[model samples]
Target chain A: MRKFLGLVGAVALLAACETAPTDGANANASGDAAAQKLGPAAGSAQDFVVNVGDRVFFGFDQYNISADARSTLEKQAMWLKKFPGVTIVLEGHADERGTREYNLALGERRANAAKEYLVSLGVDAMRIKTISYGKERPVALGHNEAAWTQNRRAVTVVTVGAGS
Target chain B: MKFCVRFLTLAVLLFSSQAWAELRVDITQGRVEPMPLAVVEFTGDNSDAAQIGAQIAQVVSADLERSGLFRPIDPKAFIQKELSMTTLPRFGDWRILNAQALVQGHAVPQANGELAIQFRLWDVNAETQMVGLAYNTVADNWRRVAHIIADTIYQRITGESGYFDTRIVYVAESGPANKRVKRLAIMDQDGAKHRFLTDGLDLVLTPRFSPTLQEITYLSYYKNTPRVYLFNIDSGRQSILGDFPGMTFAPRFSFDGTKVVMSMARDGNSDIYTMDLATRQTRRVTRHSSIDTSPSYSPDGKSIAFNSDRGGSQQIYVMDSTGKNVRRISFGKGRYATPVWSPRGDLIAFTKMTGGKFYIGVMRTDGSGERLLADGYLVESPTWAPNGRVLMFYRETLRGEKKTTKLYSVDLTGYNEREVITPLEGSDPAWSPLIP
Candidate 1:
């Protein structure tokens, strides 16, 4: 009789362990799904946030496509493909070293350069729109080279749309 | 003994030569304070006529004083008893009253049923007649005669063109912040005779008059899209400059008023483009990865001064008309924007932001000698008066629970700061040429 009680106790313990193990695995999977939803993943990629501290440089007031800018756009394009439904607005900015009107024009060219590269990588051109704030808005207000590099950037802002 | 004699002779020769030459009193360091003069009642043929003459003289006095460069003295303090322009005044009387200059004038009715106005400016210290001018106009144009007389005297004393007979074209605002309405308004420099060119059907910003004072080009948001529109001052007709598929803002007429320079945005980028008003041909001046706007032409129309962020932050830059040979001019401690070339071509005025504060400043074209003239919560859009002696800009104040913006003017010397009176909140002031 004691031997029989031991077997029943072992069965009850195994049943409780099985329930707890399945619950933990479910929690882990959901956390990963949330992360994948927030960030770029495989299969669907187009709109990706540039990591903090990364920079996109221009060639002396020229906003034409450059090799380095292409490499950066390549990475962004991969992430954008992972999230196919995302639409983006490319914001072009200029540093505080030129006239207001010319800076505005330069900013437009910069944003367009990024947009063209993305479209070449199979991102829909219709998914992107550009806006030049001229010198009206500045992310870094310092009067130094470091601040200017940050201010002169083309940012891809993601939004939810019907593409996916 | 022989050397000493030669030295003494040379010294005497030098002193006499300096004295015989024009005694130029390097007047650069004078008190920029306005000169004080007295305009008394003109003693005429009849008492009733004298009252009318006095009224005309008073108007002239007010015109000069309001310029912020002159101070009209009280007639009651006049030391001279003779107020007639035909008679020679007692110059010693004006000197005793601390008047550096005195104006005496008389008005008489002519046989042709017109008014003949005669005026004279007297130098109190030199005890001599400085200038005398005469004008014949109908009785209703007495105010204009006063202005002309003021201009003549102002030119003689200050040795500069007078700005009393000028006007200003500015954007007038009404209603609340989100759904505000703006109209292009023109008024005398003293803020009189305010007239609205547009019936508030659309929004307007930055209205600048042509060099001929006959046309204006400004940015308007008429069809839910912002574009530069040109309007004839006399005909009251309007037209758009180009059919850009995107936004266009910050428009200015070229120095010759033949071309319009503005910023056009397409595909999420804005670039500086110019269009010939007569030909309607468009050309892209800048192709850059940065935002460039607020372009101004040099007085000679050879170069343009604009604001950009290509260097990572906003700064002032100058370039040739074809967008070549570009050079950055501003290297100050703050972010500089809205660079405007002075009409005199000596300085460029701009708005600077630093340390959470904004300042109106002027710098030489080469980006040297940056001087901040004024500070406020927010200051932008520095426009030069036609003479380049004064700047008119707008300032915003951050106080209480609401924000307020108003127009203000300051001389290039950083003195004579005064608030430009407007009926409502206003910004983006552009001074116009003197009316012909």
Candidate 2:
């Protein structure tokens, strides 16, 4: 009975480890307050994510800003205005469906699409930087379209603000 | 390509071997039956030498068998047990076993600590020596000698250069799907003598070997900045290839090894560029808004083949080395990426996606003679062996919730697909030119 329980515990631990976006040290340290399940502090990185949503999705092979993404960018633009001293980095990612080199270019286009939208919405372009992870870093773990739709997104990471 | 010219040369032995003028093997086209040949264990003077000789024969047999052109006959069927190396084999014995050819050799220990090895290839039915040679090497490097002998046999039979004596550089991957740790790794073409070229602190991908030097050009994400870097295998030194304002990736060497062509993405756009290694001067190859990457130079260095989406879909395009004479070469129903020109300049291997299936295929220079060599759920990055007879690529499949990525190789005939065994998951394999 003890051996059976131990095996079950080990499998559960493996499942938990495989499903999350465990991008090494920084990722583990980023979500302490959220893990505690408390209401996020105002203007915190968690607050920005919980209130205004930091990610915007793109269509397959299309880098043009969509109407839905524009809505999210509008909210992000207002948040940036509230925290004028905040600096953000736009991280572009692609689905694993494409080649490595092409996905990198497409990812850059996705991030720049969000960056250009933020610039047009009255945020300072200098305060925002863009980097493309291609398909190397994904937030999701599946190989289906559900995961791909989430993978093909540009995430706004708060570089300097409440987290610091 | 010059240092080992003497020991490497297989003395053709023209006048004595070619008494019969009939062609034995033709692997250029069509389906080929693996020529049945008897590869006997080499005889040696001492026990240590005998063990080494048997190991050499095993390697030689495995190398020839892996090529899919020759079938090493099972040694258990040998009718005659003991035989002297100098005396020719009884032709009737080999003929009884239906072996078209016979191979025998002897290993002797030299006084100065080198090993002297002599091998002969006999056309059993022709009743004559097809080819024979003796070479010397340090005892530890007997595996290399075996590979060289395999190449000699392959060339003598098939009339094409063998890819046995080569190395492959690839990306070694671990961790999980979201945050993978990738390091640069290299090994023998048959997956022996493996070594890691970089620590896994940073991400690296797509390493390519220089055509004429022991250097590698690849993409590295050092200090969290993704760019192309060159590494010298002998010195263990690495440096960024060029100073570009934007992100640089997808680097490959020109045929002459004088220039490196790569893609630089700036402000949401990527284009092809070439940089001279000696002068550090840069030349832009493509000035387009669309993504143009994965640039490969032709063997003659007159043309450049690259992947671009300029025609509204991902396709392969060829232009003059100066970026003129633009032409689309893929008119098929799928999108193509990573167009690598064969070292022989006859075909271009590429990754194609259609109907949600990824295929590694090869096409003629003009985009005709399209042949899909291998297909899977997701396959990308097709690189050719130095001889241009086989291709190595990575294949990924989803098993339950886990993703399995592995390296695979297949010859041009669409048969003989093999999984190249590596310690860890490997991708983006680049086959080096034959080590001289």
Candidate 3:
């Protein structure tokens, strides 16, 4: 196990030097923006999904919310509380490590975990819609852990309200 | 054996012929060395018969070759040319070429504008004929005739049913990695007679054919909502299995072709369900907080094998048809998923992931005797052949920023792994039963 981890670390170091810096910059910017936008009024649900960070990561084969995921969901709940008219869709996803059917169900569990947490923070339950994409739609294309960690996540997507 | 006696009587009364009975190949166990068989080109009674005869012989020989149990010797190595199906071949000549068995055939034009195909299997060393059969079919149905003939030869040699006449349904994928366009595709088991059942307009996955071979059940993203759909391949008609409140996927028909079992996700939880195709009535088979998907019915329709994470990680479990007395069957070091019950009702094939590698393996229904047949960076979704002697799955290989997925087949013995050629990338292949 240690050897496999070391191999992954070595590959990460080699890949770090070869790939473009754009991805790192984008990821860092998103984390920074979410931290900055946690408390203030986000103006719209779309802004909440983007600036306050719409997605939260999970551990391997786990649907339980991690501490880091909890912090991100707190910010999302605050953003949701500010926009009364805004409704959101929680899109669940998983890494490609699991089977398609199981991943779909796991994605659902992850999305609902986030949704339940937001509801506990006073967000309306009916305003949130959930869908599990399983491992089909992935933001990262690589096969390494760096890509898998990003893939196993649930993103809060803002949907247009019927009245709006 | 009957044909041999009949032939001997005729030879004694009408013509002078010599015959011998010998056991050429001892197939008590799996073939460690493929039996060498010489498939002589079938002679044509007429010019029209001759053209079709050659084509039939080519198909039959190709079928035997792909089986990996019989090696069809090259015709150029034959010491004798122009074999007549009525007369026995020279055993000394075949033995010199190291052929254990010989196949001789003839095609003749029949009455009513039909073609009659006759073939005889010879045991070279024993100098005795093993099988003699004749079939009359329309000229256009020559390919099927050839397949039937191959099936007979394979059964007589190996004492196992043949899967050569079967077909496979799969998801044909193309385009860039980010945006793959997938359609449901079908082809002969030999990768011939390829056809697309659906356009690339909507994504389709995990197609399974019914026992009748006329209908297919699969998951399609119709109207952007993934749901189970039944499609009639012959009529080009389709119908939704049911109006589920949420998504339904991973559909497979029961062995009896009466029920369609699938996974339906609702309220962030997925469970196994079955819908009777005849009445459209649905029943939930598994009720659990964790995800339980990929339900496959045992051949006897008495139990179902599926994968669940209820025990905190993905593992295979088997439950009765009523969803009672559920028992965990997989206790491996890593996770197991997609537990497909073998048609023979003895083993289950699954995808195992451990140490950052994916493997296709089979285990006894009780979760013992696990054997990893194939492994790669990303390999899953194994479908068994009609005869349950082989398995087909797709493998994905990473090539820098992109990956390529292709279909591959391996024997149950974990040997003879070969690619199932496709024009485009493929995944989620489902093998159909032998064509009736």
Model 1 CA deviation exceeding 4 Å by range: A1-164, B1-31, B41-59, B109-114, B138-142
Candidate 3: which stretches are off by over 4 Å?
Answer: A1-49, A162-164, B1-31
lDDT to native, each model: 0.70, 0.87, 0.82
| Per-residue accuracy of model 1 over B211-327 as CA lDDT, tens digit each | 777788887768645578988877889998788888788898887779888877766555789999889999999988577788888999889988878898778899998899899
* Clash count list over all predictions: 53, 0, 1
Give the per-residue lDDT digits (tens) of candidate 3, residues B181-254.
Answer: 89999988888889998989987888999999988999887876778999988888989988899889889999
Q: What is the lDDT of residue B13 in candidate 3?
A: 23
Ranking by TM-score: 2, 3, 1
Question: Estimated TM-score per prediction?
Answer: 0.70, 0.91, 0.87
Restricted to chain B, the TM-score per model reads 0.88, 0.96, 0.94
- Arranged by lDDT with the best first, the candidates are 2, 3, 1
**After best superposition, candidate 3 residue A119: deviation in angstroms?**
2.4
* Cα deviation of A163, candidate 3, in Å: 11
Q: Score the docking of each candidate (DockQ).
A: 0.18, 0.63, 0.46
Model 2, B88-195: lDDT tens digits are: 688899899999988887788989787888788888888888777878888888888888889888888888989998999999999997779899999988898899
Fnat: each model in turn? 0.43, 0.78, 0.59
